[model samples]
Target: MNLKIDIDKVQYDASKRSLAKVQLNSLWGKLALNRENYDEYAIVESNEELWGYLYDKSFEVKDLFCGTKKALVRYKTVKEYNSKISRGVNVVIAA
Candidate 1:
């Protein structure tokens, strides 16, 4: 699947100072760059490490963990006290 990622909306946690949030609407569309059978994988890291990963890879997916309500609740609980704080969060892709 072709995906687009918005590098701007990605945010890090205030307490842990790690990648905490991602805005999905910023991602415009997912286009098929090429019809090649290349293995697709994602390397998850802290906000600190995200820059490095972005520099190395052409495309990456953020908020893979917080993509679901259950996952967001669990992840938010570990990161922050409020689960409601994570509402409206979304995953975006950039071309």
Candidate 2:
């Protein structure tokens, strides 16, 4: 017995194709995301917490805006937060 499968000859409904495309794109986008390149925003309520992020060598403070009860910090990690941890953002294989 013999069987053949041709992916090029297969046909799919418009809705099915759209759904598959969206799912695949989302999967790849998540894999390609680099957390280090993105900045994080946090609402620091205490001077210790605010100063901790400001003085840390690993983090680069972008902006500081003070509010009534808290301060908003926009910062990005300049160095690896944890040397033993892996971000799992594999851009090479995903591309």
Candidate 3:
């Protein structure tokens, strides 16, 4: 991602902070550019779909652990949690 940023040399607002834009492609550029695209892998697609559900369904799924523990928590496979999801219930696995 060539995040080419255009920063204002001087403060652009009363907050005395430079203005930045994330420059998303549009129209023809959007069609031509592959800047934003999703992978077609099975697991990746499943994870993406799950995230979409969590966000769209308004489920607040967040955790605070460090290192390996965090990774484990982030993608932990909880049998009970899976059952809860199957029954259409919101879940937040406390770490």
Candidate 4:
């Protein structure tokens, strides 16, 4: 048997990987087999500190999602980390 693949999907992921040096991938849904209650994990390594606060986990998270964990964290350079921190923003949703 032969399998068909979507070339665009592969290219999209490749581009995302290249641009998103850091990614937070979670597998809680895959693990629990429940997609409705699944949450997303984020990888953030933009600016070194984002004004010297977030780099060290200074940002407080209230009612945090305690069911998931970070899968991977990547950083191409300290400069990239700094840039992400300085220019990036995260939006948290209550579960």
Once superposed on the true structure, which residue ranges of model 1 sit more than 4 Å away at CA?
1-36, 57-95
lDDT of 4 at 71: 23
Per-residue lDDT value at 22 in model 4: 38
Give one digit per residue, the lDDT tens place, for model 4 in 30-76: 23343322333344333443323324453332222222432223222
What is candidate 2's local distance difference test score? 0.86
Better of 2 and 4 by TM-score: 2
- Provide the TM-score for each candidate, comma-separated: 0.19, 0.76, 0.16, 0.16
Put down candidate 3 lDDT per residue, 3-95, tens digits, no spaces: 666675644573333222223223334335432132222122344555553454333334423343222112322233334223222123211
- Model with the higher TM-score, candidate 1 or 2: 2
Q: Evaluated with lDDT, which candidate comes out highest?
A: 2
lDDT of 3: 0.33
| For every candidate, C-alpha RMSD to the true structure in Å | 23.1, 3.7, 18.7, 17.8
| Candidate-wise lDDT, in order | 0.36, 0.86, 0.33, 0.35
Ranking of models by lDDT: 2, 1, 4, 3
Clash count per candidate: 6, 0, 0, 11
- Considering TM-score, which of the candidate structures 2 and 3 is the better prediction for this target? 2
lDDT of 2 by residue, 5-33 (tens): 89999887999999999998998888888
User: What is the alpha-carbon RMSD of candidate 4 to the true structure?
Assistant: 17.8
Predict model 1's lDDT versus the native: 0.36
**Model 4: CA > 4 A from native:** 1-32, 47-95
Higher-ranked by TM-score: 1 or 3? 1
